[model samples]
Target: MGRTSRKRRSTLTTRMTIASAALLLGGGGLVAVNVYASAQEDPGQDAGGGTRQQAQQQGQQRQVATIDCPDVGTSLPDVPDGARGRVDGELATLDSQITEAYQRLASNRTAAAQDPNFVQNSILGPLKDKRGAVLDRIGQDIRRSGGRPPQGLDGMAPCTGRPSEQPQQPSQPPSQQPPGQPSQQPSQQPGDGSDGGAGDGAGGDTGNGNGPDASDFVDIKSVQPNVAVPRNQRAASRGTFTTACGRNENGKFNPDNVIVAPGVSNGAHHMHDYVGNQATDAFSSDDDLANGQTSCRNQGDKSTYYWPVLRLQNGKDEADVGADGGGKDQNVGEIQTPSSVTLKFDGNPTSKVVAMPRFLRIITGDAKAFTNGDANANASWSCTGFENRQLKDKYPICPQGSKVVRTFRFQSCWDGANADSANHRTHVAFEDPRTGACPGGFKAIPQLVQRIVYAVPPGPGFAVDSFPEQLHKAGTDHGDFINVFDDKLMQRVANCINRGDRCT
Candidate 1:
């Protein structure tokens, strides 16, 4: 059977129960599910009988991975003027309406919770199909725009309180109001607590709504300076670094707060900011990010070590995802390391960090390309080896002397962290535990990390069969995959590539 494409929508429908009902019942209601039907032209369907149970089931089908934040500096190609304007206009209208509904929901909950007759109420039922349509429309917009900005490659939008539709209010002045009340308050009524002020939602600035601006992007350039590489920790030259994969000795996952805010402890700060970072969710180490610098102020509580950190300077004018250099770039270059480089081992503060990048190359493609670290997990390929290897291992296996390479041609579909749900590529890292280096495997590599892919011309009597299939595949060891952190050789290689000559 042919594969089925995933269905997407612009707006999402959410069911909320008034807190007053929960308080009266002495417990939360059937909040596990919310039911909403389609906006049918027929008004009679609205009155049809059905318990909340059926509606709850429909919600299950709509659950999806949380949308991620967009890549900083990643810019979408110019959209057609007409389409762009239409999308912008529609979004503004939807955003305004949703904002209003959110206010009502907040107010109703506050009032209902204080009232004695508060019954379990589902906003989704009252808000109706409009909520779902909005979510559907937004999702569709992202998909239709070639998965570019506004939607963002990561689908990272600031969503709140199950999206809603405009509410119907009484045409006449509310009877419960005080005597001599005006029909409506001025547009800027401070006393009207209708819109939950700034505190209700998280935004960039107070005036423009707290959505993501270009500045919110965590650009490599922005964070590069903060990454401190003391002379001892620096590669003898430039463009090289080391990497290690290990676990927290305490046998506890490092919370998101500790990962993003390196100086802060886990319990000291709010954890929301670090939710989408790779170090917290995938690898579980700060050394990988903060340049071999782990957040823990104390030492030897569990385990920590110095990983690799590279310093690169390239002046290539490659096209990037962003108009400004905030997104992915096609310009490729490398950083060469000095003969002697030291990585600071955080565990043994006295010891130096290990590893450096001696080679550099860059290629573009989906999983078929050796350069696709974690971007191409679903693309299929046939291998010459792997007869007895366990399916558990996620890479191809080779006999003593066999090489592997992709057989098909596919367009480059690198989505970075946006399409992380279906990724298959793995990064390489040295697994140096206190006892010894992890066997066969190095440390685990993630898509979030940076790497280099170089090309080596076929040599005389170069037997492809002599290579391991794992290394032969697009990203394996043999086929031009090298760590850019190696300063000594990679720096020269980068310069050579730029000068149109091979590194001597």
Candidate 2:
């Protein structure tokens, strides 16, 4: 199926109290609680001491900008029939253009992407920011008409929590870095047609940084499952499979390779990074990945895992706004990546998960994020658990019943042999949604689906992280993953997933 638009059911407005990104914790270690206090002990004599009293006084001294937004007046612009379709069509078209902008940025070198002025003026100004204007209009019309506005757009992020609660993540696993240092971003650029290279990380680039892992901020309880997995079902002939491929703290934003399949280099035109397995790349074999170290909770599970990189940029950065849109010296605003990204094994909301065959290539999202379906824009953006068949908004606020989730499902009907194919996709096919099992020619295996959730809300100043060149925007938010599970280990996962065991 191709990308399609749907009517809004509910949405938030654009009003916001803008604040500095620095004030937010961005997911760091909790501040240590002071246990001892003394009123007269070195009140003024100690320079190393910031007494609890002094700290509280200083906090009081700082002025906090607060905004209490009133809901828009009930009166809404009456919409003529077909107006929604026109806006939907416009949004679909802009989706393509904005994707291209991110692709162009990914194709460029890091220096060019980070050049500041050029990135803002050339890419973001003309492409990303412009696309955002259209999204803003779409959202406003939805609001005025009493329809649900799209989430993830310029003004549609949720406003339920303080932005400070959002997370800022590092590109390397938390184990490698010291307490509070971000790993050095690789200087190498993409499009090695001559620019630079994916660059060798063999010895020094273990991708270590101080920022907390993106998953740290997610309070598992905040989002609950709306889909009910069947309590019991006929077991697959093959054992079940499941793996808690924890979110990677070291995934990089490498866009030039395909992490969703083998032999299809650059199939995903956006960006993604891999972790868990030390040696995951386009050409990596299943064995190579299984032997690699894992950052997942389970030590025995050396499954290679990956997802898109999210960033947080302060609003003051001169380079935040692009093109001539903001005019001269006008600050563009704070840029934020999605608040969360997650992965889970699930079934179609109505059926039980079956075992998946080995070498199945499942593409969960609209690889193209559009119907044109050109480079795997099979994009899927949702606010809850596994209601993937019901893709609606271009971006959605994390719905109350679920977290802001993005899921990727692979084809499970494997051809029985050939771990991979030249095309990188033909080896596996989708199952029958109704039966929850693979069709005639192929047998069923565990259904693998990854759900990535984010925390950006309905207020102002949150956007996806792009190469400075792409100029932060929401459509640029995307993710992908490829599995090269060891043959025997594959059976173990199948056993785990089908046995109804929640072993994270």
TM-scores for every candidate against the unseen true structure: 0.21, 0.43
Model 1 residue 15 CA deviation (Å) reads 37
Write model 2 residue lDDT over 1-504, tens digit each, in one string.
111222223221222335433232221211111001122243453576555554443222111101111111111123323344345344444534444443343333232312434434555556645555666776676666566653444642111101111112223222211111112121111211121111111111001111111211222233223232223335433233345554554433233333332333332333344554555554455555545566555565555555544433332322222221110111133322334444455433223343444334343322222111112223344554435222211234343455455555555565565444433444555554334455455555555555556665431223333322122222233444445555566556655655556544
lDDT of 1: 0.22
Report, for every candidate in turn, its global Cα lDDT versus the true structure.
Answer: 0.22, 0.36
Off by over 4 Å in 2: 1-242, 258-269, 282-291, 310-342, 346-361, 371-379, 384-393, 398-403, 459-479
Runs in model 1 deviating more than 4 A are 1-486, 489-504
Cα RMSD for predicted model 2: 19.9
Residue-level lDDT of model 1, residues 1-504, one tens digit each, is 011122222111221222221222121211111112221222333456643433433333122101111211112233332334334333333333333343243334322222322212333233334444554564456557565334442332333232111112232222111111112111112221232212122211111111111111111111111111123222221222223322222222221122111222221111011111123322233234323333232211111221111111122111211111101111011212212211211111112222222211111122111211222221221122422211110122223343222221111112222111111111122122222122242321111121221121111111110000011121211111112232443344334333333222
